[model samples]
Target: MHVVIVGAGEVGRAIAANLESSHDVVVIDQDGDIVDELTYSLDVLAIEGDGTEIATLQEAGVEEAGLVIACTDDDETNVVVCGAAKTKSDVFTIARVRRRTLLETWEGSQGAFGVDFMVCTDLLTAQTIFRISGLPSAQDVDMFAGGLVRMAEFEITSESPVAGLSVQEADRYDSLTFAGIFRDDEMVVAKGDSVMQAGDRVVVIGSPDSVSGFGDDIVTRTSNGLEEVVIVGASEIGFQAAREFEEHGYRPRLIEQDHDRAREVAEALPNTIVMESDATDTEFLAREHVDEADIVIAALDGDEKNLLVSLLAKRLGVDRTVAIIENLEYAELFETVGIDVAVNPREETAEEIVRFTRADYTEKVAMLEHDRAEVIEIEIGEDSALQGGTIAEATADLPEGVVIGAISRGGDLVTPRGTTVIEPGDHVVVFVDANVLDEVIEAI
Candidate 1:
């Protein structure tokens, strides 16, 4: 597959790196420095030209491209790039837009601006924050099989019950699979003999109910009174988070610095309380009893402002704090300092685009342990090589690190064992080693 990506920003660069190893990737940007840097850093083709122009699209091999992604900062430019790419060939086009109105208009119908798909950064980031904060224990969460199946990463604390238990010893759940563990920044493929330790991040896959129960069992913090939520800014991320919380039966209080913006958001969201005041004012926070809130979100536009406000909220005795940060380096710094979670919109968008470009086009994909492993879902066919065989027999010839996490047949979820049979039309979810991605795809 040939992929041509427009824009050399963080999102574009990330998408290129993800596809370079498996596909022929070409990147187009107006900045010569970024193009030169990408060429030197990655094994990809980089071109310096405006992506909205037809000549640039031709030079970037748009006519032969299987996928063309428009990801420039400007929404109009991205739309134009997609439209121009369509003129060159009948390629699959994906447009990245930030404006909600434009996205809604395009998403209502097909062939709108020649975009086959659209991705919104604010919406994706908000969804991520909502998932992690809603579960309150998983560092990362992704859904599959139409929300029936789930994958989550839980951090094992010293107070956790399974802290020192081996993988075999911690096999308490009937429908759960421990995919892998991250200990001391190293990826350890989980097995029966692998032992879990404190401060380790473990990835697990299973049904949603089973995964939620597993999280509750391992996390030290009680989820009894996580009813109150405080939002620091009325930015897009904050507003979307508040809305998500309300839909999930949580009434959030949103605070905005500007009076007009606060009034607008307050009107838009009937259930949310709109407070017009600076979040940095400790006296105001005390008057409002911010310390009693279960979680506080820092979503200001500036990274520095978000960091400072999160630190202050933590000091005020908030149990959990989530901050929206732009710089990848600062995300690590904020996590080390005190913030419970840091959400990066650019990285999330890039990940979603990469999922859409995979060769097999798996039902879903979740990157774990900094892209060292992946959890993928696919459906078995009637004439396939894996059908009609037991789970153990089907996977015996494959790599050692892969594990069949779950199997669903006719809406019935099955926790696979040695005797489980691989019937046709069953949706099988597997965790694969990053190094054996190509082999796994071929086998599937």
Candidate 2:
């Protein structure tokens, strides 16, 4: 398959890198320097031209392309690029936009902008924040199999009860599976004897109840639980996040420095408390009792300000801190400095787009630890290697990095075991090392 991507920014570059291994990828950008860098950095063809132009689309072989993605910074540009690609060919088009209004417009009338799929960056980030906040100590969370199966990644702190326990010993949840463990720079496929050490990020997949139970056990929860929420900033992402929390039955507090923006959000969000004050003001925070909040989210306009807000919240005795980071390179730095979780909008958008490029059998994909590993839900076909055989028998022919996390059959959750038989039409959620993802997809 040939994939054509526009705007060689973080989102485009990420999608290119993920697909270049299996498909013929071509990236087009207006910036000569970024195009030149991508040409050498990734194993994909790079072109320097305006992706919204007809001549540029022809130059990138849009007619023969199976997928075309537009991910420029401007929403209008991305929509125009997709519309232009549709004029040239019947290729599947995806547009990455930051505005929820555009996504809603597209959703109301599918294929309105000639885009077969649209990814809203701000809305996706807000949804991600809401999902992470719902869990006790999760670093990342994703739902698969139509919300019947959930995959979550959690950090094992030294004080965690399951920090030093083996995988078998820590496997207490009824329908949970310890999929993989990510130690510093190393991806360890979970096994019965695999020991989960402190500082390791463990990925689990199971029913929603079981995953929630596992999370509660991993971290000692406060008596009040995660109730009080404070969001700093009136940026689109922050405003959307506050709205998400409100819709989910929590009256969150939103702090905006600008008076006009604060008044606007206050009127728009009936359940959220909008405050017009600088989030950096320590005295204001003290007066408002921000120190008693369960979680503080920094979604300011700039990365530096978000970092500062997250650090201040931590110093103010917040239980958890989540910050929205624009620069991908600063994700690790923010987490290391003190932020509990750093959400990158571009990364999230890339993951959402890349899932559409997977095989027809793959229903969903969740990238973990910045693509170190992946949890994918695939439906079993009659000719699949997994069908008509026990998991132990089927896995013997597979690589060591694959772990069958859960099985969904006829809308029922099925816990995977060695002797479990995988029938046709069963949706199996599997955790696989990124290195072996292609092989596993091909085999299953």
Candidate 3:
């Protein structure tokens, strides 16, 4: 397949890198320096031109392209690029936008603006924060197989009950699989004897009830379970997060420095308490009793400001701190320096776009730990290697780094075991290392 991507920003670059390994990729950018850098950094062809122009689309061979992605920083530019590409060919078009109103408009009228699909970065990030806040100590969370299966990444702190337990001992939950463990820079595939260390990050997949049960058991609960939420910023992401909490019956507090923005959001979110003040004001935070918050989310405009607010909140006795990081390089530093989680909007948007590029067999895809591993949902066909055979027998011909996480048959949950027989038409969720992704996708 030939794919054409416009605007070689972080999001575009990530999508190109993921597709360049299996498909022919072409990236377009207006900046000569970025185009030159991408030419040498990735395997895709780099073109310097205006993506919204017809001549530029012709130069990139858009007529022969199967997919066209517009992920520029500006929402208007991305929508225009997709519309212009539609004039040249009947290729599938995807646009990445930051505003929820545009997504809602596009949803109401599908195929409007010549975009076949649209992803809202702010809304996706807000949804991600809400999902992570529900589970204790979860770094990341995603649902698959029509919400029947869930995948979560958790950090094993010293206070966790499963910190010093082996994989076999921790396998007491029903319909759950310990997929992999990340210890420092090394990735360890989970086994019966694999011991989970204090600082390790573990990935698990199973039914929603079992996953929630496991999370509740591992962490030491406080007397007040994650109830009080404080969001610092009136940015689109922050405002949407506050609305999410409100819709779920939680009255969250939102702090904004700008008076007009604070008034606007306050009127929009009646259930939420909106305060107009600087989040970095130590006196104001203390006066408002912000130190008693269970969770503090920093969604300010600048990364430095968000970092400062998160650290201050942590120092003020907040239980958990989540910061919105624009720079991908700062994600690890933020977490290592005491922030519980760092949510990158561009990374989340890129992962959502890359899902549509997977093979026809895969129904859903979730990238974990910066694409080091993937959890994919697929339906078994009659000719698949896994159909009509026990899991132990079928896995003998497959490579390492593959685990059958969960199976859905006839709208019911089926726990996978060595002797479990996988039949045709079963929706199987599998955890696979990125190194062996292509082989596993082809075999299954």
Best by lDDT: 2
Q: Is candidate 1 or candidate 2 better by lDDT?
A: 2
- In order, candidate lDDTs are 0.86, 0.93, 0.92
In candidate 1, the residue pairs with backbone N, CA or C atoms under 3 Å apart (3 or more residues apart, or in different chains) clash, namely none
Cα lDDT tens digits, model 1, 121-227, are 88888888888876656778998777778889888888889989999999889789888888866888888899999888888889888888888888656347478
Clashing pairs in 3: none
Tell me the lDDT of candidate 3.
0.92
Question: Candidates sorted by lDDT, descending order?
Answer: 2, 3, 1
TM-scores for all candidates: the values are 0.95, 0.98, 0.97
Q: Give the Cα-based TM-score of candidate 3 against the true structure.
A: 0.97
1-444, model 2: which lDDT tens digit per residue?
999999899999889989989999999999999988998899999999999999999999999999999999999999999999999899999999999999999999979999999999999999999999988879999999999999999999998999889999988888999999999999999999999998999999999999988888888777457889999998999999999999989999999999899999999999999999999999999999999999999999999999999999999888899999999999989988979999999999999998887856589999998898999999999889999989999999998899999999999999999999999999999999999888988999
Which ten-residue region of model 1 has the weakest summed lDDT?
218-227
Give lDDT tens digits, candidate 3, residues 330-370. Answer: 99999989999999999999999999777566899999899
